[model samples]
Target: MSALETVRIREAGATLAAEAARFSGYGWMRGTSGNLSLVLDRDPLVLAVTASGLDKSELTDTDIVLIDGDGVSIDGDDPRPPSAEAGLHAHIAARTGAGAVFHVHAFDAVIAGHRWPGGIELRDMEMLKGIGHSAHDETVWIPVIENDQDMTVEADHFDRVYVPATAEVPEVPVLIVANHGMYAWGADAAEARRHLEIAEWLVRFTVATR
Candidate 1:
């Protein structure tokens, strides 16, 4: 990698680290459970993913590892391992053209997923507009898939449920892994964070009022 490219990635890592830390402060990513990733370059498919088992509350640029499209760590001499969900991130990016992806282990997400294993359908909520629906009558469905210990198995399940954004899918930015957590993505880091924040909040509100 060129020196300039390395600098750019480090900068992006610093910014993403801060975002992850803020989510951790919100009790969403307590400990080292959740993972965050940003696509650094598309042609070469370089991504900066959170290092495995690193406390999100204390995330730093160095806690990010550079990986290739295949989710293999390509960061030279960086002993840190990429997040176990790295492959999942790659799949989302490839399928959705997302520049960033976030996975969070939040209480509301787990609760909602269990309560609505078929899927969580939010309707008549003002926040529905924030998720891209044009009107109040529209319903937003967040699919809940069963979680698996094997990342490959989880990815396969996600592929089955995840339909690429078409008229039917309506650009749904988040999904839940039953009793596990939520996955959100967007065109970039900020958008991904916004989607995640909005999705999680919507679930919390739904669960509280029920």
Candidate 2:
């Protein structure tokens, strides 16, 4: 890779590390249970994924690995392997055109998924605006898919439930994996974090109410 590309990868790693730390502080990514990825290239689909088995709160800029569309490590120099969920991150990016994907094992996400196996529906809430919905009279459905250990199988399940945005329906940027956690994505790192936070908040509210 050229010097510029190398610099970009390093920058992406730092961004992921900081984001991971933020989530870890909330106990959502405790004990290396979550992963984050940033899309570096779109055509061939290259990503900078957080390295496997590292404490999210302690990661440095070097604690990341480059992976391809198939989650195969492309950075030979980096001894660390990509996170086990890297393939799922790649799949989400490919399907949604998202530039960043974040997975977190938030407790409320698990509870909400378990309570609403079909999906979680929230309407007419001011918080709904955070996920890009109208604050009034707009109903948002957060789909929940069954959790699977195999990344490929999980990706397939996500595909089955994903609905693209239309004039009548806005795009849902987050989804919960039943008995697992949640995945949120956006056009970039900051937006992805926002989506994840908002989704968690919504789920927490739902769980508390019902």
Which number leads on lDDT?
2
- Among residues 3 or more apart in sequence or in different chains, the pairs in candidate 2 whose N, CA or C atoms overlap within 3 Å are none
Q: Residues 155-199, candidate 1: write the lDDT tens digits.
A: 788888886667754778898999889999999888888889888
Best of the candidates, TM-score: 2
lDDT of each structure? 0.86, 0.93
The digit string of per-residue lDDT tens for model 2 on 42-94 reads 99999999999989999998888989998889977778888998999999999
Q: Which TM-score value belongs to model 2?
A: 0.97
lDDT of 1: 0.86
Alpha-carbon deviation at 165 in model 1, angstroms: 2.4
For all candidates, the clash counts are 0, 0
Give the residue spans of candidate 2 off by over 4 A.
Answer: none
lDDT of model 1, residue 92? 81
Q: Candidate 1, residue 66: CA error in Å?
A: 1.4
Model 1 sits at a Cα RMSD from the real structure of: 1.5
> What's the CA error at residue 59 for candidate 2, in Å?
0.5
